[model samples]
Target: MTSIVSLPIVIPLATAAGMLLVRRNILLQRVIGVVGSAALLAAAIKLLYVCYTEGIQVLQLGTWPAPFGISLVCDVFSGIMLVLAGIMSLTTSLYAVADIERRRTAFGFYSLLHILMMGICGAFLTGDLFNLYVWFEVMLIASFVLIALGGEKPQMEGAIKYVALNLIASMILVAAVGLVYGLTGSLNMADVAVHLRDVRQEGVVLGIAILFMAAFGIKAAVFPVFFWLPASYHTPPAAISAVFAGLLTKVGVYALIRTFTLIFTENPQLTHAALVVIAAATMLSGVLGAAVQMDFRRVLSFHIISQIGYMVLGLALFTPLAIAGAVFYILHHIIVKANLFFVSGVVHRLRGTYDLKKLGGLYATHVWLGVLFMIPAMSLAGIPPLSGFWAKLAIIRSGLEIEAYWVVGVALFVGLLTLYSMTKIWAEAFWKEPASPGPIGYASTSGLGWMVVPIVLLAAITVAIGLGAEPAFEVATKAGQELVNPQIYIDAVLGGRQ
Candidate 1:
């Protein structure tokens, strides 16, 4: 069980090292990336199954006991996150085979990608506040270079903004971790939770809580902190954007969920209330931003911010059902969001520009492509019988259960606005006539199988989740139960020592 807990991070770490060793052979690097990511996906699934059937699994490094050694913990929630990370890693690696340019490949793209995955997995799996901070830095370094990989003018501009904000977030994260250790004498999250109960500094506790929130909030791209995401995500290659869209911000959200539930459960009236406001504002602001964007990926990027609101709202509501909703939303959005980006890349392959005004008539010529776009686009809009619908339904319904009518209303309105944005993309990019043919002529099917295959697989998963919402929701609901009662996690990590 402990070995399974570590495999998600180990597989990627090893793959990245292998890729580096064979830097000159792009073919070998691609093979290692794809095979390694697939193994990661398998391990993630096995980890989830073990957690669900057995209970939370915890690994203390070097045989050291709790509060004295590093811990890797996997509860149902983290296991679900690990599975989503695996799916995205595998698909993105596949997509990049055909999508990333030769120059980027030769420049260690596969190595960087695996490193990013390793960081993300470590963040999800770590049970220490300081370890989480370390993973954040790892992700930051890798993603900074990834966004700036092409060295294009826009990529550089976006990378600068991305790194600048993240570095500040990183500083705050470290400070918050230091505060936790100072107050609790433990960097272990479970130990911190146990020790915090003995601390009498109410003012300092809440202050530290807010500091942590601000730090993770920036990385999660909520509310006013989200400007960097739209500016950066669109500038990268589609494969990079797909992985970033699926995993990076969610790592921040994962930290938020873990910290608040396990370490900062005190004063929910104040802490969770702040989250509610941030969630509503994030949703409204993101959709509004997306509504006006003419660029394909930019619109989708803003929608990512909006969709994050739904996930956060789940955490804010702070109930079992609500947490389940959040878990479900995070899983659903990862697949749907990445697929949407994949579709955008395919569109770019056919049409030279992301500008909506200049792009047109994909439906007439590439009927399958239009259908592919609609599945995720409609899912993003929360249409019924799709994955997004169940995800949004859970969140909205959870809000209603708690009578959070105002935020619930905001959520419903955001859904309507989301629908409008999807229609805008559909009308401009698919339904409307192309002002002219593709500048370089349309790509043949033979040239697109690598990219298209990943999109198809993700789309199929979205549909599966939608159609299988009950079982899917069951998984989320169980995970939510674990979160709503953090003792399950604490007990797993500490094994009664605390």
Candidate 2:
């Protein structure tokens, strides 16, 4: 099981090194990228199955005991994330085959993609704060390179803001880790949780908690700190944007959920209450901002911030069902959001523009494309019989259960606004006739089969999860149960050592 837990990180890191060596052969690079990501998907599925049946899997490096050695731990929550990382990695890698130019591909794009996935896997699996920071740095380096791969003017501009804000986040995260170590005398999260139980520095602990929140809030792109997301997300190639949309900020959200539930439980009233306010603000601001954007990708980017609020709201509500909904939402949003970006890329390939006013008649020209776009778009808007519908229901129902009517009202209104934004895209991009007379700007679909495959597969998953949600819901419920009860994780990480 420990070996299985390590496979998600190990597979990608190895593939990245392999890809770097074969960087000149574009054919080989694509093969390696696709095959490697596919292999990772298999490994992640295996890990999920193993963890589900056998419980949390842990690996202590160099055979060192808990709290002394680096540990890789995979519980139900981490398992779910690992599975998501695998699916997105494969899909984005496939999209990159067609979307990325050969010049960019030759310059180590495949390598960087694997490295980014490795970092995400490591972040999900690490059992200690120090390594978590290390994984964050790894992700930052890979993502910075990937975003700035082609050196386009907009890419560089976006990269600057992205890197600058993230560096600040890294500094704060490092500072928080140092504070936690100084206060608890442990870098291992489970061990720190145990020590904090006996520590008497309540005020200091609370302050450190706030520091963590701010640092991760920036990474998660919540509320006022989220400007960097829309500024940068639309700058990269759609494949890059899709992967980032799917995985990056969610890593921060995952960290927040893990730490708050496992290690920072003492100040729920202070911390969680603050999270509730932040969540509502993030949702309203994101959706409202999206409602006004005319560019295809930019609108999707802003909505990322809005949908993040729903997941955060789940964590903020801090109920078993709310947390479960948050988990389900993570899965649903990753698929739908990434697919939407992929669809944007496909539209750009066909129409040569992302401007809504300049683009139209997709439905008439490419009916299949229109259908693909709507599956995820409608799901994202939380329409019935789609994955997003269930995900939203979980969070809203949990809010209802707790009788937090104000946030619930805010959430429901935001859903309506999200639908409005989706409708705007539908009307402008697909519904209306093309701006020009006949055959305005359709590109050849030659060699685009790979790109279309992933979009269709992801859209199918969105529908399947909606119609057959019980299994996913059960997994989410079990995951939320583990999150709400920290003893399972603590014991897995530090059974009798402490």
Candidate 3:
């Protein structure tokens, strides 16, 4: 199983290289991208099964020992993330087949996308901080180009905001890495955790943690640092936006969870408390931003930030159940959010605009689209018996268990506001009558099949998750247990080398 651990990373890297060689052939590029993504998904599912059945799997590069050479580790958490990445990657590739213009396709869009997947998978699997930073840089380069691929004015403007803020985040992250190496004399996460236990410079350590929090926080788009997400996320093609929605920010959140739980556990009173506050603020701000948005994509973009708060709430509570909730929320949010963006893309194709005021009567005319949109939309809003309901319930229940009343109250309030935003989109974009029909040349379903297929599959996944919440929750619980007590991860990465 350890031999299979690197397949997720390798497949994308190899696939992207292959696509680059055939960049002129859009058909071949699409074929390579989709097949590679399918392979990655298969590898991810295998890894998840291995982690569950066998225990944590680790592969030390060049057979080097921990704290010395690179290590790729897959625990339940990483396995779960890899699975989500695979889903998003495959779906995005499918959507891009029909949605992306030939000009963009010829411009190495598929190559860059696979490169992005490599980075995301690397981030998930790496067992060290320096490599994590390297992966972040990899993602940043790919995403910047992906966002600005068309060279449109809006894309350029949005790309600038996204890249500028993220660059600051990158610099801060590398600086934090430097400090961690300087203090602990190690870059391996497991090794660093062990070293930090012996260090006595509490103040310096706390400062480093804060720096990490800021760096990953910006990457995660938490609280005041999240404006970049809303400004830029809606500017990309729907396929690109869907992939970003599903995986990018989640990487940042994953970093936070890994560091806070594994390496920075000593200062929970201050660090975790600060996290709780940030989570609440992030939740409120995001929903409020969504409440007034006029564009369909923009509204979803803002809600991404809002939903992020719930995931963080799971981390901030720092309990086993909370961690479980966070894991569950991550699982639910990625599929539902990605599908919403996919739905918006279909809407845009049909109506020639993302403006909510311009779209209407979709529910009456395109009844399947309406049902597809509502499945994810209602799930996002935490409607009962759906994925979001159970995800939010676990997080809220966790908060209530610890009497974190203030953040809990904020969470419930944010859910209500989230529903309002979803309702607003439904009323404006689906229920009301449009003044004009879609533009010519888009009435046929010739190209839409590839795009809608992913939406249908993702929506089905959402429904399945809702109906079979027990087994999914069990997976989340085991993942949460691993996170809460990270000794298993540490031992796997260290390989008894300590």
Clashes of each: 0, 0, 0
TM-score for each of the candidates:
0.99, 0.99, 0.98
lDDT score, candidate 3: 0.93
Q: What TM-score should be assigned to candidate 1?
A: 0.99
After superposition on all C-alphas, the RMSD of every candidate to the true structure, in Å, is 1.1, 1.1, 1.2
Clashing residue pairs found in predicted model 2? none
Write one digit per residue (lDDT tens) for candidate 2, span 98-197.
9998999999999999999999999999999999999999999999999999999999999999999999999999999999999988999999999999
What digit string (tens of lDDT, one per residue) describes model 3 on residues 1-498?
377988989999999999989978989999999999999999999999999888899998878888799999999999999999999999999999999989999999999999999999999999989999999999999999999999989999999999999999999999999999999999999999999999999999999999999999999999989999999999988999999988899999999999999999999999999999999999999999998899999999999999999998899999999999999999999999999999999988887788898788888778999999999999999998899999999999999999999899999999999999999999998998776766433544559999999999999999999999999999999999999887888887886678
Error of 2 at 388 (Å): 0.7
Models ranked on lDDT: 2, 3, 1
- Top of the candidates by lDDT: 2
